[model samples]
Target: MRKKHEAPLDTLNSYLPVGAYHTVMQYLGHYKVHLTITKERRSVLGDYRFAVHGKNHRISVNGNLNAFAFLITLLHELAHLIAFEKYGNRIASHGKEWKLVYGEILQQFLLLDLFPPDIANEIKTTMRSPAAGSCAEDGLIRVLRKYDRKGDVKKLVEEIDVNGLFRTDDGRIFKRGDQLRKRIRCLEIKTGKIYLFSPVYEVTPVSHP
Candidate 1:
C-alpha cells in the first residue's frame, strides 16, 4: 500500500536538522533516487530499490510516525543507497563501509546522535555481549507461550544466582526465576521450578572473557 511519491523529499526535508538538508542533497545528487514513507510492511526497517530506469527508497513507519524514527529510518535507508552506490553490495550490511558512513553522517552531517539516547545506549551495551537472543527473555517467553498449549507447561525451580540472569541481544536482562504470564513461565523462588508451556531457546550464562 505504498505510493511511489508518498513521502516526498520536500516533506522529509522539513524533519532534517538545519544543515543536514544540504548534506543529504550532496550525498544523493547522482542517483535521482526518490524517498517515500508509507504505512507498508517493510521487509527490513527500510529498503532501497535500484531498477535499470531509476532508484527508489521506501521506509515503513508502521504507525511509529514520530520524527525520531522517521529520521533514523531515513538515514538507515540512505545508508543502504550510499553503500550500493559506492560499494555495489560487496560488503555485508552494517559492515565496515556502512558503519563508517553511518557514523560519519550521524555525527558530522546530521549533527545529532544515530539513535535516541536510550536506544543508542542499548546498542552500546549489546555490542559488549555476543551470545544474546533476538528478543528479551520475557519476550521470548511470551512468544513461546503463544505457540504452546495448556498442561504442556513445565515447572522449573532453581536458586537465585547472579549468573541466572539472561541478557538479550538488545542488552535487556531477565532473571531465571522471574514470573512471566506472557510466557506462562515462572521459577519458584525456593523450589526453582521453571514453569513453561513450551520449551523456548535456552539462555546460557555469559562467561567473562
Candidate 2:
C-alpha cells in the first residue's frame, strides 16, 4: 500500500484566522523563539525539540491531529519555548516555570472564548481540579468527545490543553513528562528524579463545520 501524504503546514495555515496567527507570531517574537511545525510522531501529542546547530526550533504534531489538537499542541510547545527562554536551565522540565507560563497562556486563549460551551466548561473544570490519576481518563474522554463533535469545531479548540496533560499521584499533582510516559510516579534511583507520564491514547480535535 502506498503511504498516505500528510497535510502540509500551509494547508493547515489557511484554516487559522489571520488575527490568531499573528498573535501567535507576536508571542513567538516576545520570547525570541523560532519553530517549524511538521507532521511527525511526537512522543506525546506534541513535542518541542530545540535545534542543535541553530537558533531554530521544531514542533512535531501528529499528522492526523485534528484542528483543536493542532492548536493546543502549538500553544503547548510555545509554553516550553517561553519557559526555556526565561529560565534557561534553572527550572525543572515540568516545574514552576512551565506551570506559570501554561496558566498564563491558557488564560489568554480562554479569554478568546473560541471553544464550544461544553468543551469550554470541561476545560475550566479540568483546570480547577488537581491533577490526579483519575482525572486523566475522564479528561481524555472529554477532550475526545469534544473533538469528534461536528459543526463549529473551532469552538472546541479552546478545550485542548496544549501546555501539557496533568496527572496526580498520591494526592500530588504533576504535569506529563514528570515521570515515564505510562507508569505514574515512577522513580529513578540514580537521579532521584520524578517522572510524569503522558496518557496513553490519541485524541483528535473537533473541526469547525
Candidate 3:
C-alpha cells in the first residue's frame, strides 16, 4: 500500500531533474517523507522537520527553483532529516555531523552527472564542507542561476553595475552602490535610505536617461 505521505512518482518527476525520479522516490518511500513544493520564499530555499508523535518526516522545497537548484535543496533538507535521525538532536543543526551526512548524500547525485559541467564542479567544491544554506555558496548559486527560466527578467543585485539603477519587486528603486564585504549597499531612490542587499537578490534593471 502506498504511504499517505508519499507522492506519486509521476507527480514527483515534474519537480525534479530528468533521471532523478527513481532515486529520489526510493528515499522518500523508504523514509515515508511528506514533501511539499512551495512558492518562492525570501528567507529559505527548503526546510526539514523530523517526524514526531506519529507525524512523518516533512520536507519542503521552493517551487520556483530550476531543476538543479531544486535537487540540491531537496538533498539539503533530506540531510537534515537523516542527521536528526542519526544524532537524535544531540548535535548542532549544521554542525560536523550534518555536514558529513549532507556531503555524502550530495556525492551520490554528483556521481550521476545530473548537472552541467560548471554546476557540477561548483557542487563538488561545495560538498567538501557544505554550508548551512545552499545560497551561501556564491559560486554554486551563480552557476545554478543559469538554469532559471529564460523568460525571467529579474537580475541578481551583484549583476548590477556600481551606481546603476534597479527596481526591486516591491516597486522600490535603488542605485546600486559599493560592496561592503559580502553584502552590497544600495541607495533607495524614494527615501534616500541605503540598504544592504544579498548579492543574489533579484531586481529589475532601470535604464537611466
**Each candidate: what lDDT?**
0.46, 0.51, 0.85
TM-score of each: 0.47, 0.56, 0.89
Number of the top lDDT candidate: 3
Considering TM-score, where higher is better, how would the candidates rank from best to worst? Answer: 3, 2, 1
Alpha carbon deviation, residue 45, candidate 3 (Å) = 1.5
Q: Candidate 1, overall lDDT?
A: 0.46
Model 3 steric clash pairs: none
Count the clashes in each prediction: 11, 13, 0
Those runs of model 2 whose alpha carbons end farther than 4 Å from true positions after fitting are 1-12, 15-19, 29-34, 38-42, 51-54, 128-137, 149-209
Candidate 1 wrongly placed segments (more than 4 Å): 1-5, 14-20, 51-63, 110-209
lDDT by residue (129-209, candidate 2, tens digit) is 323222233564456445643653222212334433322222332222333334434333334466543344332332221
Candidate 2 vs 3: which has more lDDT: 3
Q: Rank the candidates by lDDT, best first.
A: 3, 2, 1
Candidate 3 structure quality by residue, lDDT tens digits, 60-146: 888788888999999988988888888887789999989999999889998877778898899889988787885568888888899
